[model samples]
Target chain A: MKTWIEKQKALIDFTLASLARRKIKNLGLLLVYTLIVFLLASVMLFTHALRKEAGKVLENSPEVIVQRLVAGRHDLIPPGYLEKIGRIRGVQKKEGRLWGYYYDGVLKANYTFMVPQPDALMAVESGKIAVGATMARMRGLVPGNTISFRSYSGKLFSFEVSSVLPNKSELVSADLVLLSEADFRAFFELPPGYYNDIVLSVANPLEVRNIATKLSTLLPDSRPILREEVLRTYESIFNWREGIVLVLLSGAILAFAIFAWEKASGLSAEEKREIGILKAIGWETGDVIKMKFWEGALVSLAAFLLGYIAAYLHVFRFSSWLFEPVLKGWAVLYPRFELTPEVDGFQVATLFLFTVFPYAVATIVPIWRAAITDPDAVMRG
Target chain B: MIEVSEVRKAFNQGRHNEYWALKGISLTIEAKKVTALCGPSGSGKTTLLTIIGCLARPTSGRVRLKERDISGLPERFLTDIRRSTFGFVFQQFNLIKGLSALDNVMLPAYPLGGDWRALRARAESLLDSLGLAHRREARVEWLSGGEQQRVAIARALVNDPEVLIADEPTANLDTALSKEFLAILEALAEQGRTVLLTSHDPLVVEAAVIDSVIDMRDGQIVGIR
Candidate 1:
């Protein structure tokens, strides 16, 4: 009997020659299979990267935030809430903030604002107002330049841009502008002591829930928000988008599965007779199985590689357009992000095992059954 | 050497269908002899040959090759026995259409790998000896029926099996080609290899230098000569 390696080599050689003979059919199958895989890989990579970016932005943000809820609407807390929240034992530092939404009637764009620099009081900046990089670029605004718009209260407010900031978080930074608390009040014509919210930094984040409970009891109308809650909301939104993508692309996956099964099992009567001839010539059932295995492996491996490469270029590079609706929902996503190509070796290995191995195994079942039959019976047909 | 003891094989069902292909027939083929099993269509000639070659299991009774009972062996073991001990030549030649005549001949040796160069040398010599050396590189599909038959013969003999089985070996060929093919089989028999062949042609049965003839009708051997 021939050694296992010799049998494998012969099987591989024969399989390759057979595929080469049917170039057109095999090539068409390969192209379609690869395209689906590419799309899947790109979506997986882009969504994963977006999750990481959003997490990072939240992690570096304030531990707790105090906002006023009125008639099912989130309103700004008075500036005095800052001093009251600062007195809590676990609170390391507390700062009052002023933020609001503005609209450009000419450009038909929405802009969000937060107090900046000195009294602005967040980890990001103080009195200097920051604007989104994309918005600045689109509107032709630069640092130390004034941009004016109408606030939600319908009052016209103008502020000098302190610096144009890159959209670090595409989910959040798209249409944002920043200013000092005094500037925020003056621009929106707020009373002297009023502010939007008080953001607090805690030494230990795990104690945030306990602290918020105490704050709620002490201050009835004001509510405490944890950064974790914000991050969870973002994750839920992305999870929904992932589900939609999976549903939309599932048809392609099913088509690929069917095509692979058909290629493996749907041998013609002529092909069966040929298999009989080989068997009658003393070829083992294992050799016949090995030949079909090579055919499956070659087709799937080629498709996997080609599809992954195409997805990287088409889906990841231009992901901002593909996924914008899901990420932004009703809110507009201003800074479109470019996904960095992340090849997860484990994920790729899993994909190959899950997607290709079963198909290859499926191809062999019918061939094995036919090969083990009486060679004379096969030849007679 | 091949021994068949009261082997039975059947096919299909009911009053209209349940017909035996081979029925309680016993035969022995001596080592190094060219023996032909001849009968008309549906006479169990091919069925008997398949049982003798270990390509099919009998519905009853035992078959032994070189004193080893092959009937009860597992499929894998039977496959190994077939690979090492038997070589088959089909009526249609059954050459893979895409391969060269040499490749077709060398195929059976692929499982018994040693030096592929040595296998190639052996295949080339067998084809050369059979007057097919000039057509060694030609695709099997492009070859004449006679040429394809010679290639099939070469393939059957390539692995140096103890038993050579050829089913209706010349059914597709002209009289001249059939005679030429029989001449090759006679040469292999002279080399002390046991050959079991099936045929419906009386001319093929008469022209060949066979040691014995087993005649069958209705799946049962009616006479022996």
Candidate 2:
């Protein structure tokens, strides 16, 4: 056992020296390999973080949202809707939600205006508003500043900025404005006794679907949306986008595989002679294979580490600008949030399977073929 | 002793370019003596040397090492035999580029892996014996043709094999270096190790230290002296 370990150590020593001998060529291959890994890993890590954020944000959402439909389109729920929902058996809390999208013609962006639920992440007092971090940054407004927005009825309403939401919640609140329910109704010129939707929070997850079904039967004109279904929809959308990008990137991966295969099989005359000489001097086919394996392993492992670290920094630090337009979609009022640094073992292992495994196979197959041939024939050539 | 009986070797068998390199050749190589196979380029001298050294297997007939048939052995066993029993010196020396003389000498002993420190010591001793102690850490590409040849010789001898097989030992050397190489061969033979060599160079074919000469043409033995 000791001798076997020693043998492998010697092979690794020789392999390192051999790689250094062709330093430029090997380094070029490493650079291209690292780039390929960086591209794929960035897409993967970004998508994974976005998905995790979505699930976490939705974690606090009501299990069921009941929206009144007028001619199959979402309409405002009438005043008596919450009374009609009226304490479903499994529901822990029930309330009406008020929210609407307001297009700011000046900034050419949309802001989500909503009434604070009181159990909201941050408090908003009556007649005053709390703007999200991005909104404050864009408008240069501080807590004491007053901002005005024209109503749909062409009337201007001004309110004091009570607070600016922190950046940590930017993904969910990037273009958000939290005002009192009365202000939200007045800004949209909406009358009293109307809510955008009705929300029911159920303590038991298993009872959510049952409650949703009961609500549908009770309110035939309303559509019930379950939180899990919304989460699944977002999950599928991100996965579909990620899959499309991966398919498009497969061409690059294939090119890299071909490059690796060509590099491994197309031995330079000097390299061929080296193999022949090693074999002739009493090194066996197995020994030669072991040495080549070390060469492949060392190069691939280094590429993986460099690429993954680069991708992590690219996505989390620099916001993965290279892939944002595609992976995260286009937005005028984009989140501009930093992704939390985390690695999914399964995803990384899968990436390893995609990258290093193929390279090692490409490197070993040709070397094994060469090693099995007669040393005399190869040397003579 | 090594024995070759009716051994034949072919290249690209069953193909259009198929050509037999050796034809029904038979000979005996005595222990602790220097023997040379002399022939022109197309002759079977090198092919026979490769076959007897276990670097290539014959297509027909048999070869015996100490009365044990080795012709039909598998490549795994043949490699083992080559590693344990024979050392090879090629025409170009074939010292791996970018490696020091000591590293080249240590290549054959790497698989054995007895003790790395002891192996390094032995490799150093072999290089010193070949008058390459001062050049032990020099990369092979930096060495002269004669120095490279000696490194190859030291590499071959590092495993301490009993049979030394050198193919065209002086093919790449000038006259003086060729003579120096021949003197080294004579000295190794005098150390009670069997030395087998192949060369068409007259300087090697007619060397005084060569105990026997087998002349060949067209893959068949033409004369023996």
Candidate 3:
């Protein structure tokens, strides 16, 4: 076993030297290979991190959101709607949520206006408000600054910025403005006992689905959306976007594979002579194959590491600047938050299978052909 | 001693380019002596040398080492015999370019890996003996033809095999280098090594150190001296 290890080390050393000899050609190949890996890895890392961030944003959300439907369209819950949901089993608490989208003509962006939940981190005074970090940045608001916007009812209201929402939850709260219930109802001219939706908090996770089903059955015109379903939708959306980007880059992947295949299969005259010399010196067919294997492995592993590190930095550090537009979808005021640095082992394994393993296999048959040829014939040629 | 009996080798058998390089060749080489196969191009001397070296297989007949037939052995066994029992020097030297002389000399022993320090010592000692101690670290391409030839010889001897097979060892050498190569072989032979070589060089055939010379034409032996 020691001898075998020594032999492999010797081969790796020789392979490195050999690769360095043709530095120009090999480096060009490496550049292209790294680019391919970087492209694929960036998409995977970005989407995965986005999924994780979305899950984190929804972590404390109500277990079920019941939206009333009228004429097959989402409509505001009318009076007595909360009473109608009075006694659902497994529901710890049920509350009405008031929220709506406000189109700010000045910024040409839509902001979500909502009354703060009871457990919100910051409480708003009757005439004050708390805007998200992104919203504050766009409007250049500080704690003492006041901003005014015209409501749909042709009424103007000014509110002081109590605090900027935390950056940690920026993905979901980027365009949020939390105001007191009096300010909200006055701005929207909403009458008493009406809400955009009803949120139910269930202590038992298994009971969330049961309560949702009961809500849907009891209130025929209501839609009970579970947190799991929301999470699944988020996952599918990211996956779909990732798939689209990958499909768009399929040509590049194919070209790189062909390039890898071509480079591996085409042994130059000098290379052939080198193998002939090795065999003539009593190096066995297995030994030659082993050397070639080391060569491919070193190249593949280097490219993989370099590419993955680059992609990780691109996604988590630089915000994946190259692919942000396509992956983030169309939005006027998008979040610029850092994805938590994390690596999925299964993803890395899958990437290895797609990139390194195939290239290693590609080199075997060609090297074996050269190895098995008699040294006499090769020298004579 | 090495023995060859009725060995025949054909390339691309039954094809349009079919050609036999050796035919019914039978010869015996005594241990601890220098023997030469003298023939013109296409005379099959190199072909017969390869068959004996275990580098190529014979289409028919048998080659025996120490009276043990190796004709039907598996490739792995044949490779083992080649590494342990035979070393080869080609006409072109065949030293891998871009490697130092010491590295080229150390190439043969890499497969039978054991005590690399000892192997490096042996290779260095061989180069030192051949008056190349200063050139050991120089790349093979930078070395002169005679220096390259010595490096190839060092590589062939690195494993300390019993028989040394040279296919036209002097084909690419000047007269002085060729004579120097012959003297090296004679010294190796005196050290109880069998020197098997193929060449058409008159100086090699007439060398005083050579014990016997076999002449061949059209893939058949024509004379023995």
Candidate 4:
């Protein structure tokens, strides 16, 4: 076993030297290989981070939300519905939430406006508002700066920025604004006993789904969204987007496959001579194949590690501008947030099996064929 | 001792383009002596050398090295025999080009699965004996033809094999280097290692220390001296 390990080390050393000898060609392949892995990994990591961030915020979300539907469209729920929901068997607490989207003509972007809870981090005064850090940056608004926007009622409402939300909450609150209830109701022209939706908590976690079903039965036109369903929806959306990007990236992947195949199948004249010489010098067919295996494995493993680390930095640290347009294409105001750093063993294994395994296998037939032939025939050629 | 009897090799067998490279050639190579095979091009001298070296299989007949018939063995067993018992020097000095001289010499022993330190030491000693110690770290491509030939010889001796086979080993060298290579082979034979070589060079065939000269024509042994 010690001897076998030493031989492997020697083989690895020889492979590194051989690869370095053809630095220009091999470096070019490494760069292109790294880029392919980077693009695919960035897409995967970004979507994963988005889903994870959404899931984190969902932990704080109400177990169920009841929204009124009229004529197949969402409408304001009557505050009376909250009282009825609070009376349900599993209902622990129920609150009426007032929120709507306000489109700023000046910035040409939409910001979510909501009434702040009493125990919220930022308690707004009657006419003041607290905005998110990204919102503040987009509008050049700081604390004590006043901004104005026209509501759905065609009335202009102005409020002073109290404080911007911290960067840690940027994923969820990037476009959120919080104001007092009086100002929120007046700005949206929402009357008393009405809310955009009603959020309800259940005393028992398992009974939450049961409460949702009961609520749907009681209010025929009401839609009760479960937290799990929301998470599943988030996952599917990202998966769909990832599938589309993969389709677009297939061209590059195909190009790499062709490159690998060409290199493996052609077996350069120099390579043939080397194999012939090795066999001529009393090296067995297994030994020659083992050396070639090390060569392929070294190249594949180096490319994998370099590509993965580079993709990690690109997605989480550098924000992956290369793939930003494709992933966040539809959003005019892209979220300025860092993706959480995550390393998924399964994904790394998948990348290895996908990228390295085939390239390694591509070499076996060619190497074996060279090994099995008479050394004189190959050297003479 | 190595014995060959009625060996024949045909390429493109069972086809219209079939050509026989060797036909019914039988000879014996004595241990601890220098023997030479002299023939013109296409005389099948190299083919016979390869069969005896276990580098190729014969279509018929037997090759017995120490009374073991190896002509019909499977490839894996043949490979093991080749690794443990035979060292080969080719006409083109087929040293793996990118590796240094020491590395090339050490290539044959990698499959032996021993302490690499011992292997390196053995390779180093062989290179030192061949006056190539100073050139140990130089790549084969950077070395001259004579230096490359010496490196190939060192590689052939690294495994301490019982038999050494050379096919036109002096084909690429000038007269001076060819004579030097012959002297090295004579010394190796003096050390009790059997040496068999094929050469077209008269200087190589007429060397004073050769035990016998075998001449071939049309893939058949024409004379033995």
Top candidate by lDDT: 2
- How many steric overlaps are in each model, in order? 11, 0, 0, 0
Residue A107, candidate 3: Cα error in Å is: 2.4
For candidate 3, write residues B1-225 as lDDT tens digits.
888999898999999999988888998999888899998999999888888888788999999989999987877888899889988888888888888999888888888767778888999999998889999999999999999989988888999999988888888899999989988977897798888899899999999988999999989989999
Candidates, DockQ? 0.52, 0.70, 0.65, 0.61
Model 2 C-alpha lDDT per residue in residues A298-345, reported as the tens digit of each score:
998999999999999999999989867666633467767888887899
lDDT of each: 0.77, 0.88, 0.87, 0.83
Q: lDDT per residue, candidate 4, A283-370, as tens digits?
A: 7788888988887777767778888888889888987777776664233455677767877777777877888788788877799888
Error of 2 at B84 (Å): 1.2
**Candidate 1 structure quality by residue, lDDT tens digits, A1-381:** 456676667667778877886688788778766766776776676666677767877887888888888875788676576667766789888777677777676667777877653543333333456777667777888988877766666766666677777655545666777766666776788887677777788888688998899789877898888898989988887777877887887897788768766765677676677788777777777777777788978988888888777767765566646555654333443566665556777778877787678767777888888877767664464
What TM-score fits each model? 0.89, 0.95, 0.96, 0.96
Ranking by DockQ: 2, 3, 4, 1
- Give the lowest summed-lDDT range of ten residues in model 3 chain A: A328-337
Tens-place lDDT digits, model 1, residues B41-80: 8998878887777788888899987798998887778878
lDDT of 3: 0.87
Q: Which ten residues in a row are the worst by lDDT in model 3 chain B?
A: B108-117
Q: After superposition, how far is residue B142 of candidate 2 from its true place, in Å?
A: 1.8
Candidate 1's C-alpha runs over 4 A off are A117-130, A137-147, A151-163, A167-171, A180-182, A318-324, A327-330, A343-350, B13-16, B112-117, B131-138, B222-225
State the lDDT of candidate 2 residue by residue for B1-225, as single tens digits: 999999999989999999999989999999998999998998988889889999899999899999999999998899899989999898878888888889899999887767888999999999898899999999999999999999999999988999999889898999999999988988897798899999889998888999999999999999998
| lDDT tens digits by residue: candidate 4, B140-177 | 99999999989988898888889888889888888898
How far does residue A296 in candidate 4 sit from its true spot (Å)? 0.8
